[model samples]
Target: MVQFRKDNILDRLVIVNDSSSEVEGEGNRDDHNVGTCIYCPGNEHLTKPAVLVLVQKEGIVRRLSDTEDNRIDDWCVRVVPSSNPLVSISANGTYSNKPFYSEPAYGYHYLLVASREHCRPSYIPAEQWSNVLVALQDRVKWLYMQKGVSYVAVYMDYDASSGWHPNLNIVTFPYMPPLIEQEVESINRYINEAGLCPICNIVSMEDKSPRHLVSIENFTALCPWAPTYPYEFWIVPKRHGIQLLRMTQKEIDELATMLRVMLGGLYTALGDVRFSMIVHASSEKSRKQLHWHIEVHPRLVDKHGLEDGFGVHFLSVSPEYAASKLSVASRRELAKLVGIT
Candidate 1:
């Protein structure tokens, strides 16, 4: 979740853990599809191999996509790593363990399959919702087991946030800035204190704690703090030394459940918005030290604005009123309009 250091006018490319509540408004963004919403879950064959497992009380098993699944269904929230991935999780955790070192970035990326139903998270029942969390836990465990993976992170673009699609994200990566020693020295003398990567602080919160339990539902819209936009929120798992690719069955089930309410709330608020989700983790499979979290971004605009001089945000409304206007009934009506369950 790194923003542009300069901040002249950051493009959409550097959106690591950023979310927006009101759209900025654009020139010809008519390409948005407000008609229907489709997901991946019941459509097992349509997605990649099960990166994580989600089992219902009825014993239904589902996996998230690996950024490879083209078609999805209503019963699932398929995930896909970037076709042009930037980070690497194949290396071990260089950020956490001082003694352990491997390739710059040797980690893995896994997709999160939200549910077996097409409806929004609000529509999902409580158990199934918990299943989503359990699946996430299972995947987090699996990622840690890898020899090269160092970290695993989950993400989602909830409702109008990224188009209101209920899904999960996972990311595993290695921290290797070329001027490593110089960077440390520079920070120590001028910035503020000794070796301090602010993220390192959060990482330390659960760096060694296994029973790390972070609530993803609360926060400034289920996304990371300082969300680019107003309604960004997050759900990072507290397990310090685990990845998100390999999780226990129980964990996977419970994680899925958490996603249900998180997403469902978005649906309950927004009216069938569109969104996306994915996982960010260490590359190359090197096991390292890093915490995991799930993020949610709702794309909604209540009032129009001028952040779009050329053609970036072009939102139709303001965030204050938009957040107030969006509600459960409206969301349900929109969900039905889009053919969501």
Candidate 2:
């Protein structure tokens, strides 16, 4: 049996496939292989030149980039162009309104090397996560300033079998993605009707609910009321914000702490499972109405025909149960990581 659930703000619907099945753990820690990996610290020549690099020297961090002849080996973080980019800068920006309306996929794509290590089961330290976020902010802000760029997408896919090196994908789009456009419309509708941001209300409401996982200084991690995947969770800011570029250093550090703690808790509770982390924010045009957030979706099962054909998600575990298990583990992890106990 299944129960249909609708998203709180969006018109999205999901089906709880089985409310009674136990949430089983699935993940394994794989050994690191640095010899053949290209993203490692010493193999900078295997990929394109880095667009941005952060190097720490004499207790001061310096921002540098790779030239055709030079590659900085001593770096904390690096951003390089994707070898197989999703979009190209030299693409023809032609558009036609014919039956098969199409335009060039004109944009940019880059890879963010989040760590010097090749592969690891554990999440990066909070301080290193802070550095990664700062680098991300720098790239996102720069991309938004370019003409014709409408959106910047940041996400990470981590799987043990895929040589899960700590890296993130940054892609730019000339137009708003359909899902984000829908969210913008929904957010504006809620603001007009309820006179408050829906995400702010959600944070306040879920702060004490069973779906609430953990709350760090300025950010909170919680399971959504209706999730598309088992054990899906989101990290959102307590205060309303539009873009990651505007985050202060303090806020970035706190957000990094929240990510480290929550992700560590996830691994502690569920082992080394595969997951995707996505950043959702409004484009420049709709920035005023949307509240940005980071969503983590653990890939626990495969999708079936009903989900693909009907646009309905089937979830094996309910958000309440997931929150119950994750909150306890995450809280303990947080205590150990930050001495909250």
Candidate 3:
């Protein structure tokens, strides 16, 4: 979280808090809310009731195919409402259109717990990751149909070194966000100038460039040329899909495999580095012109005054070098697994 100071113009800070103070029984180990791990299996009561659950059977993962009347105790992944939500669903879907630019923050906030155990993405199995993505796609499709929801933001902040849990936040907004708006404008401008989608062109160009890291059947990962942070990389689908909901089941499986490999590579290369994995998709207005992708920002360096004052970013290592290192690390890590290599 980047914060500004009213007292000093150049003063800025990145606040990194693992848990909220409002969480009930946050520190009591005997209450089953043990050690900041309310997302674990036994602590389901600590959070909202599970809206969705996926379970594994004989090495295959599937949604808990049980009647709503019967609840299940075993689940590989669970989706629940955030205890401290930034927004909530309103019955009337009403807003206060004031003169000073204000409105009601009414929307749904859900947390997709990827695992029953407390671990990072690097340690999660590929099957479980696939289940998480399937659940995410299902939830996003449902959230977009809500009364006041115009856009859904999906992101994960995994800083296991600081005891942060690995979970994805799905927050709906009543209107299009500013950053997404800016991205759509840029994509439109690029299409007009180049006669093609910039990201689709990037998928082709990066695969042939020195900054290329890995390429699966449906997706390819590369280090962006002008990254805002060090070791920043992007994973884009080879097929031109506008939203994650449009991905096929095979695509989701392939994506999970790529995530596990790339995240494992990062873990091997940089010991316990904190990172943010953000998904950028097309808004309702720009669905046809924009392509979806994932951006990874490894928190390896600090953001100083120069970065905050201006929107300029400085990188200590070049993307070509970073890609080469990650490529080697991925290969080395994959070799350790039985049948991966």
Candidate number achieving the greatest lDDT relative to the actual structure: 2
lDDT of 2 by residue, 100-206 (tens): 35456667878888888756425698888888999999999899999768989888878866554688888787777667877889999999999999999999999
- Candidate 1 lDDT trough over 10 residues, lowest sum: 211-220
lDDT of 3 by residue, 91-208 (tens): 2323322232233456787888787766767888777778989999888888877777888988887766444346888877766666777787898899989898888898998877
149 Cα displacement, candidate 3 (Å): 1.0
Worst 10 residues of 3 by lDDT: 1-10
Candidate 2 residue runs with Cα over 4 Å from true position: 1-35, 285-288
What local lDDT does model 2 show for residue 154?
86
lDDT of each: 0.42, 0.79, 0.73
- Candidate 2: clashing residue pairs, number: 0
Which portions of model 3 show Cα errors greater than 4 Å?
A: 1-36, 59-71, 90-99, 162-165, 284-288, 333-341
TM-score, per-candidate, Cα-based: 0.44, 0.87, 0.84
Q: Best candidate per TM-score, number?
A: 2
lDDT of 1 by residue, 104-172 (tens): 344455555454444455666656555566665666677657664444555554443343334555555
lDDT comparing candidate 1 with the true structure = 0.42
